[model samples]
Target: MINTLRANLANGIQTSSTRKFRSATRLLTFAAIAAFGLASTSSASAACNGGSTLKGRFGVLVSGGTKAGAGKYVDGTMTFDGACGVNGFVSVGENGTVNNFISVTGSYNTNADNTISLSLALPNGTETYDIGFSPIFGEAIGVETDGTAYATIDLKPQTAKVVSSAPVTTYNNATLKGTWAAACTAGSPGQVDLNYITIDGSTSNYGTFGNVTGVDHIYQAQFGIQPIAGQYAVLSDGTFGGSLTVAGAYPFGFTGSISSNGNELQYNVIYGTGVIEACIAKRVS
Candidate 1:
């Protein structure tokens, strides 16, 4: 089963549109196994105090490239025990029903440098991940220990707690207004393009999109400007919701929901050609 899953992940990586989704699905498959197979009651070591920083539920987005140049993204949720254990679910496809769905359980160690080492035990094998946390607390970036894959994840605390500082004001035109450093990926068959932009989200949000090629390298700026227009609403429940349109050479329809803490935004977007992309963006004001 592990070999089959690996084969599927490798095959999915070759295609641009579904690479991350496929990889996430496989991860979730192991999650499901762990949830049912592993024991839930485990004590944390004295060195694991950093787990407290990860308590609560978080929305996760993972994107990485394979040694062969295939790019993949994974979307899911992870819940930490504030001790050392973690349980989560991941999926691929529209509404998480398309290709695969999975639940995972694991142990983690928080390093002194704000990085984490995670180990997930699956029916087939154990996978290790090295994760780096953002200064914002819950947001993090990660990569496989073998360097075969890399990913970025944004986590939103599901429970109310004192953030590093007082919570930012509610999501409004004023609070949302800023120049944000944005990274995005547009995936299609045989080609996956990464985009980096400086987004000004004031009255009418607009920015320049740079076509980034080569693994983890940002080259010169490419042609064309991307424009976005949208309105955001702070729901009664404290979640942030909004919709926007990308009026550019390759247009996209985007909808997003942000955590109450105002640190991370989870987005689901569809291209004019009907290709779907999902990502998490952090506020860098």
Candidate 2:
């Protein structure tokens, strides 16, 4: 179906009657696929299952973040070689100088994004990663080089050996669980409250929801109001609201939109006007 769609999309925008017929033919084909459900792959599902034998550790470059001790940090092995899964350990960097080991594991399935929401355990505690990667291989991942579409892990203790790692399960929305750092913007003092989605069903349509803390007027500390769940789509209402069953221990919510950028699940949530609070909560997933 994806291939058919791609072909139809690139067939050149048509206007002639003959072209229209072809366009209708392609559209009908896509519809037929949708009705019959041509989007199912068991191999992808099993890639990040509980136990499998295809496991391995990898080493990749670290980029992004501007803190003095932020760039070029490697502490744990990007480990995960299993039959029905894919995962890795993000090396320790500025925030990784304390925890002994920090890693994640889970299953993933997507063409544009190689991801799984594995469990992320650290010295401070354990959380899940909106874990993402490009090119699913043993140790040959991290091709984007900007650290944009990878697991957004918290800084942990530095260790030479990879202590742990696993594949994140997308079916469980592992992309919507984690600790996010948001500031107490200028005006929205109380505590910036936000909620959002992190999992990218694709590079396009997916959802992340949130609310933010109001700004602090006196101390000037950008404290935030975290949702018990990592994100929300309810918009303060209870309808489409998404909740993180694992964020109650924190204090700030998030500020991003559940979006799909015409490709796959990508969090396009930004700091919009009244649409969002002062400080924004974006899904780094």
Candidate 3:
């Protein structure tokens, strides 16, 4: 059952790009509002059951090194309303020069497998990105549909002091704190097997989750290019959660879910230059 789900998850990542054009069109409505400075009144809150996990304020970083001729990077903050609306500003950098802040807007689709599809409107064009959340839900990692750019997003509950005040209801951390074996696969290719243990109510034990074994370096690197090792903080509201960088070589974030019984944890880990790795961690003790 686990393998089947993992395979399906992998397939979803591969096919997510097919909807790029369609996604762009759907986001135009929000883009127009953002361009006109009407974002303050834009509402994405809807009374829907199974509340969305994408609601909150996110710090985003986009990086593409000469993939399209000139290296590009974007730093900005984006806000999502848990339904499908998003708005933000991006500081675009090209060839090591900071350009100007550009307003952006878009819509997103939350997939059944915990992946997210986003269509963001930039001044130049609309671009699509596929993001994956980690088991706890604090961070997201994504890449442009054309693979020309990549991004890492750090999210925090809009109401930090009162998580319950957020639009969505999340799981309790006491029910999900533990150690488990983890297996991860990237959208591109290859798989990684490792172990992860979460504790302190909101932090993870940092370790590697990539090609440490005698796996093929090329294939392993495709999915597990960097060592999947870092300390991650579980979001206050649960819902697979998010993370913050306390002290580390790279920033980390993730979102996902723990099975009702708390034995299974499924999530995506986002880190270093926009890489999203789907991970399943099963409690063994």
Candidate 4:
């Protein structure tokens, strides 16, 4: 009986040791997997190369106030050198009128934390912005940093990278042959205008000049929906312009650039009311 009891005690000790060994092995395996996941996340976040990541042409939109006045809006295309220099043309609206396309020059720097700083020399003065990049979306988003003005800016790649297909190098009238939904904002400090428009650009009645008809719904005015008629023309380089009459009376002009994928358009309106208006349209059909 004594021998049997001793044997039983020895077996119990061996079993407990085996169980502890298995538990330790599982803990090590879990720790290794967690470390691998953390390493992957760190590597992905490290891919941002700062301002040098911005290259080629980017469609730009700027809307807000300047040090002198309110309601300044700008939209155009900017070409970045992937180093420090940038130049572009923009249509600026201010003081009850919209200026013709004007040239703008700017310089940018990369911060230690991977953020970007930009200084744009405009016709009025130098405007500064704190810019941030999103690798997943491939865009640069920023806001005005100067105390006097309140504005926000965004830039989208004019040329899409080649992945499964060749990138769209140029665009013409037929490239915009579809329906589009547009979200737009226009305003000064006290007065703001917001509109949602559904544009039908699929009609081919006017040859290269596409007949566009849409409904403009002004949310602020509470004017449910008004029918608008317009015509648009796309340039070889994807710059588009058109005039639309709202409710058959009020007329406004607009211009913008199409994305390299031909899936989106970024545009601004010429309201000539001392307010800047910016709109982005995406294809729906």
Score candidate 2 by lDDT.
0.29
TM-score: the better of candidates 3 and 4:
4
> RMSD in angstroms, candidate 4?
27.6
Better of 1 and 2 by lDDT: 1
lDDT scores of the candidates, listed in order: 0.46, 0.29, 0.46, 0.63
lDDT of 4 by residue, 1-285 (tens): 334434655577444323323322332233233223221211112233354666667778877766676566778777766666677666777545666456667777778888788788777678788888765556788998967577788887766563344457876667877778777766544443334444444435334346567777655555557787765666655566666666665446667777777777788766535355777787887
What is candidate 1's lDDT per residue for 1-285, written digit by digit as tens? 335545766765453223333423333344344334323444454566578666655555555443454444445455668797877554332221222225557778888786888775433345567777654554556776745445444556544343565554344434434434445553433433223323333433111111111121122344234455433333222233333334423323333344556655665444444344555556665
Angstrom error of the Cα, residue 24, model 4: value is 75
Please give, for residues 139-233, the per-residue lDDT of candidate 2 as tens digits.
22222222322223321111112223333212222333433433322222232333332332221112232322222222325423333322333
Q: Each model's TM-score, in the order given?
A: 0.48, 0.23, 0.39, 0.73
| Index of the highest-TM-score prediction | 4
Candidate 1: pairs in clash: 20-72, 20-73, 28-102, 31-103, 31-104, 32-103
The positional error of residue 238 in candidate 4, measured at the CA in angstroms, is: 1.9
Candidate closer to the true structure by TM-score (higher is better), 1 or 4? 4
How far in Å is the alpha carbon of 90 misplaced in model 3? 1.5
